[model samples]
Target: MRRYETIFIASPTLTDEQAEELVKHFEGIIAEQNGELLKTEKWGRKKLAYEVQKFSEGYYTLFDMNAGPTLIAELERRFRNHDSVIKYMSVRMDEQTKAAERQKVRYEREGRRKAQAGIKERSLEEVMG
Candidate 1:
C-alpha cells in the first residue's frame, strides 16, 4: 500500500449533513477497496480562487489514506460520476511526510479532546481569562 492524499471540493449548496454524508460516502469507498484511512479533515466552506461550475464557494474535504493503484483509479472514477463533486485531486505521499502526518493527527485529536472537556468544565470568560 502507498500513502496518498485526496482533496475534493463539493458544491456549496449542500447542507452540513449532506456534506458530511458525501464525505463519508467516499471514505467508505476507500475502505471497501482495502484502503486504510489515516485522517480526514473538513476545511468547511471557503471562497474559491476561481469559478468552478459557476460557483464561487465550495466545501473542501481532505482525505489521507494508504491504498493500491486499482483503488486509486476506482476512487477517481467515482468522483467523476458524482455530480456534486466540483473538483478532486489525489497525490502520493512521501514516507517522511506520512510519518509527520501520523504525529500531527495524534496531537490534533488529543488537543480536541482537551478542548471539549474544558468547555464542559469552565465558562467562556473563565476559560478565556
Candidate 2:
C-alpha cells in the first residue's frame, strides 16, 4: 500500500452535522476498501485563493492514508460524484517524501530529548555547587 494525502473542500452551506457526515462517509469508503487511515484534519472554513464554484470560502478537510491504486481510484471517483465537494486533490507520497518526513520526526524527537537532558544537567550542577 502506498501513502497518500487527500484534501477536499465542501460547500460552505452545509450544516456542521452534514459536514461531519460527509467526512464519515469517505472514511467508511477507505475502511471498506482495506485502506489504513492514518490521520484526518478539518481545517474549518477558510478563504480560497480564488472563488471556487462561485463560493469564496469552503470547509477544508484533509486525509492521510495508506491504500492501493484501486482504493485511490474509488475514493477519487466518489469525490468527483459528490455534489458538496467543490474542489479536491490527492497526492501520492513517494519514497523521498516518506524519508523526509521520517527524518523530520527524528530531528524533532532528538531536539526534545536534548533539551530535557540539558535542563536536568543544569539542575544537578546547581544543586551540587
Candidate 3:
C-alpha cells in the first residue's frame, strides 16, 4: 500500500448535502477497494484559481489514503465520467513528504504543550505577585 492524496473540485451548484453525498460516494469507492482512508477534509466552496466547466467556484474535498495504483486509476476514471466533478488530481506521497508531515504534526503538538505551560506559569506568577 502507498499513501496518496486526492483533491477533487465539485460543482459549486451543489448543496452541502449533495456535496457530502458526493464525497461519501468517492469514499465508498476507496473502501470497496480495501483502501485505508487516513483523512478527509472539506474545504467548502471557494473561488477557483481558474474557471472550470464554466464555473468560477467549486466545492473542494481532499482525501489522504493508502491504496494500490489500480485503485487510484479506478477512482480517477470514475471522476472523469462524473458530471459533478469538475477537476481532480491525485499524487503519490513520497517518503520525504511523509516525513515532513510527521515532523509538522509533532511540532504542532509540542507548540500546544508549550502554550499551555506558559499559560499555567503566567497564572502562577499572577498569584505570587
TM-score of each: 0.73, 0.74, 0.74
RMSD of 2: 7.3
For candidate 2, lDDT tens digit of each residue in 1-129? 999999999999999899999999999999999999999999988999999989999999999999999999999999999999999998898776988999999988887998988844357768899
Count of clashes in candidate 1: 0
Cα error, residue 93 of model 2, in Å, equals: 1.1
Candidate 1, residues 61-114, lDDT tens digits: the string is 999999998999999999999999999999988777878999999988887998
- Superposed model 2: Cα runs more than 4 Å off: 98-129
| lDDT head-to-head 2 vs 3, winner | 3
Off by over 4 Å in 1: 95-129
RMSD of each predicted structure: 11.2, 7.3, 7.8
Residue pairs clashing, model 2: none
Model 2 TM-score relative to the real fold: 0.74
Instruction: Report every candidate's CA lDDT.
Output: 0.94, 0.93, 0.95
Clashing pairs in 1: none
Candidate 1 lDDT for residue 66: 90
Off by over 4 Å in 3: 95-129
